[model samples]
Target: MRETVRWRNAVFAVFFAMGFGFASLAARFPTARDALDISVDQLGLALLGISIGSIAGLSTASHVVARLGTRAVVSVGVVVVGVGLAIAGWGVEARSMAVLVVGLVVTGLANGITDVAMNLSGAANERALAKPIMPIFHAFFSFGTVAGAGFGALGEATGLGMGPQMTIVLVAIGALSVVVRPRLVEQPIQPEDHVGFRERLSVWTDARTWLIGGLVLGMALTEGSANDWLALLMVDGHDFDPVGAALAFALFLTAMTAGRLAGVPLIERFGRVAMLRATGALAAVGLVLVIVVDDQVVALVGTALWGLGASLGFPIGMSAAADDARMATARVGAVATIGYVAFLAGPPMLGFLGEHLGLRDAMWVVLAFVLLSLATSAVAREPRTASGAPDPAAEVRP
Candidate 1:
């Protein structure tokens, strides 16, 4: 039990670090734009590098995990992420779009690999503990983002440039990676016959897997959209300054953190489907509020609601995909790959829309995805037993 606790804490640290690194980059989006002297559409096009690299990484994550184990993959991924951050910072400082795109692509690849490996570790921990803890782990991720964004905001307010800021964050994450390396859980080696590339990839043919992927896709859009563009929208659409915009983005992440922390018990009491439906409604209402209301206070409130609504979908999708433990890695890889379609497509699509309709208006696209997630929430039911029978006892709640 003590060992389990230690492992869990180690995984929490990893998630926190990942969130912190990503949010650090996110908070600097405006700076990158200004430094590079790029238009919104150009920025969006450049951001496509992340999508391209993330898709590549997601496609091959299961095989990497199978070969190298989660701990090693995560360790290597952290170093690569640091290198990517340094490169991105250099690009921003030098005002080179080509360099910036390369940096983003590299960062995205490392991030994608780290994402699957850490979630797999979290799922394994959940099985060992016999409880619903995935949301709590994700809450720590939100906490990390909050810290990173807040730090970036402070730096921005104080006149710190993007280059120095990212360098400091990268160094911190690299050190943390070393500290947490020893505590990660190690999976037993599987025989080659147990999980071939073909068999591992077979989850793609499962209808239920695609439904879960669809649900995750919507949630990913909801969350990824906010991560990539919320602050910029506030600045461009609402006439807010950069610091204020950063604070607003931080508020969204804080609300998300609170929602995830509060969701653990709610999920225990209500089951996954009911809670998802309620949150989906909250997200839709939130986005509507942001679109129609001009008042900053009202918009921020809507942002909070949107954050709460989106908090559960991605993490819950991961938990659902891992329900059949024997096939966890493969299923997780499939779900993550499908879900990332939103990340891959969101930036350029929204940028194009923002070019004509405005950023605020383009966000209405989020509503369509939210509704789709609500429609498919029922597919997230518990996994079946070995006899292929539904196991009520194995459901997320009682």
Candidate 2:
């Protein structure tokens, strides 16, 4: 138990750093916009480069993690994120939009690498520990979001150009990540499954895998939506100040952490499917509350519902992806990659919907997908484990 706790602690720290760095970009949005002198549409386009890079990088993640092992991969990922942040910060200081875009692309790639590697490593750790651990790892990300908001305010107070401010933040987090890595159980990754392209294609073609994968896709979309637009909606729709708007996100993530801690036991009592169904309703209810309420307190409660509903998705989905006895790790990787692509696509698509139909209406679209995921989860098949999990039917949520 002690070793297990230490390993998870390391994973948690890395997650915290990644989440903090990523969330800080939310703070920099206005600065990026003003520095480039661009309209909202142009700003969206420029930012789309990051999403594009994430999509491209996710395609190769299994290969990278398989070859490098999670330890080295995670280490490199942290460094990459730090360097990309620095570059973006430098671009902002230089007042070069082109350079900023390039920097964002690099940042996106780094984000993609870390995202997949950490999820895989977290899953591996959960398996080794014989417990549900992924939620705790993600809980740290929530902590980071709260911390990042503060970090950003400090950066702004210093009156440094975004480049210097963000670089300092990223560098500090990256150093912590290095210190954290050695404490974890870093194992040598085996060579990826040798199934050829034609075999891999067959796994993708399966109806059940797609059903499970679709659940992953929807959840990813919902989380990404919260990440990209929760602050904007509070500010634009509710007329919140910057700090107030950020607090909405902080509320949402705090609820997410609390929910995950609660979820461990619930997932133990029920399978991934039952918990997913519950979260879907919870999220939809939250969205409705946010849309209909006038009181700030009520609105914040709605965000908390949204967070609780979203907390367990990736862990559950990854388990489902590996459920097929016949599927290879490569195929599992493919499904996970597809889900992230959905994540990349979701936010901007939501932005477009928000722009055209109002943010509330766009938020409704997310609820629609959440409902679909709930229905799908009811029948989602379990992954066929190579080593029989301590108890597959036990409360393993992820």
Candidate 3:
């Protein structure tokens, strides 16, 4: 296989591993919590280690990209993530928060760095492919998520303990890390062109970027709210069991995966603006359906609708960042900083709102965000010129 193919495969694998890891923990969380005798508060604090490290890692991505090149950062991230799994697995046996934090931070940094590198690489690859392939590529991450979730059940069915199970998973991931190490290409990222670290840093001041960033923030907030609260909402509010409530989220993930995978060709044919506008409307309607109906079946369908509608959020936004010929790379960096914090902050904010207002009412908070997201996406200009050449403004306007 070509080096680039292998590199892309690694990208897919990295996301796949993250998905699987998330699933294993999700499946085993009840047992793990019982075994450790840890409260929700303690677990939250433990999880903070990963979140903190991911935030720190994301903040420094530009310098990392400039210095190490895309391939090295991603490869290092993959290796570090594997190390994290190793630590996390051992920590599970030892029941040590300190060890677990180490693993969390390692995996967090790995994921953070790899996220930036992969998106940039995928965007670059999109240019080479002369079509929109990025949406489908990001869908691989979604596939990993589903596979990992399902794998947890399979692991239990097979009577594989967490230690051996995690070890086997880590081994597979580590081998792939090494195999793809040499496949990544070191290209001068076009997105970073004509933008200095300082100027790139100044994306905070760009109104257009902020417009888009705010939109991204809203999407993440809504999605995070749903991810953290949906199952609980179904169970606590509607009196469903763990399995029944979980089915809602499972449907959401499936719908989201389908939407994003299908979004690829749609973007290529209709353009980003049209896709965003349409999807944005669909999400809005989905939220409304959930709000209006008290029926569980309809609400679950709303969840799927929300998923499908929200599917295009990040990839399409990144496409917009990379739309500018002169500053695609740097803008992506700037946009990422503003947008990523929402992932960290969203659930907490929604929880606070739910506490004050009501859980259902808190979802209404996301309605505002969703509307803002659609408006912000109006600035998602399509790329016309190939490189940073002075041309008709029409070329940059989508």
Give the clash count for each candidate. Answer: 0, 4, 3
Which residue pairs collide in model 1, if any? none
lDDT: the better of candidates 2 and 3: 2
lDDT score for residue 75 of model 1: 77
> Pick by lDDT: which candidate is best?
1
Would you estimate the TM-scores of all the predictions? 0.96, 0.87, 0.82
* Candidate 2 lDDT by residue in tens digits, 1-398: 78777877888888888878877776556556567776544556666767887877776766676566678878778778877777777887887878877877898887787777776667666766767666777778777876776666556555667777777777787788768778756642232445445665676677766777788888877777787778777876777766677667777777877877776787767767788888878888998888788778888889999988888776677666654423534445676767776556765677677667766677887888787778778644443356855346332323
Ranking by lDDT: 1, 2, 3
Deviation (Å) of 73 in candidate 3: 1.2
lDDT of 2 at 289: 89
RMSD of each: 2.3, 3.4, 4.2
- Lowest-lDDT window of 10 residues in candidate 2? 389-398
Better of 1 and 3 by lDDT: 1
Residue ranges of candidate 1 with Cα displaced over 4 Å: 188-193, 384-398
Per-residue lDDT value at 219 in model 3: 69
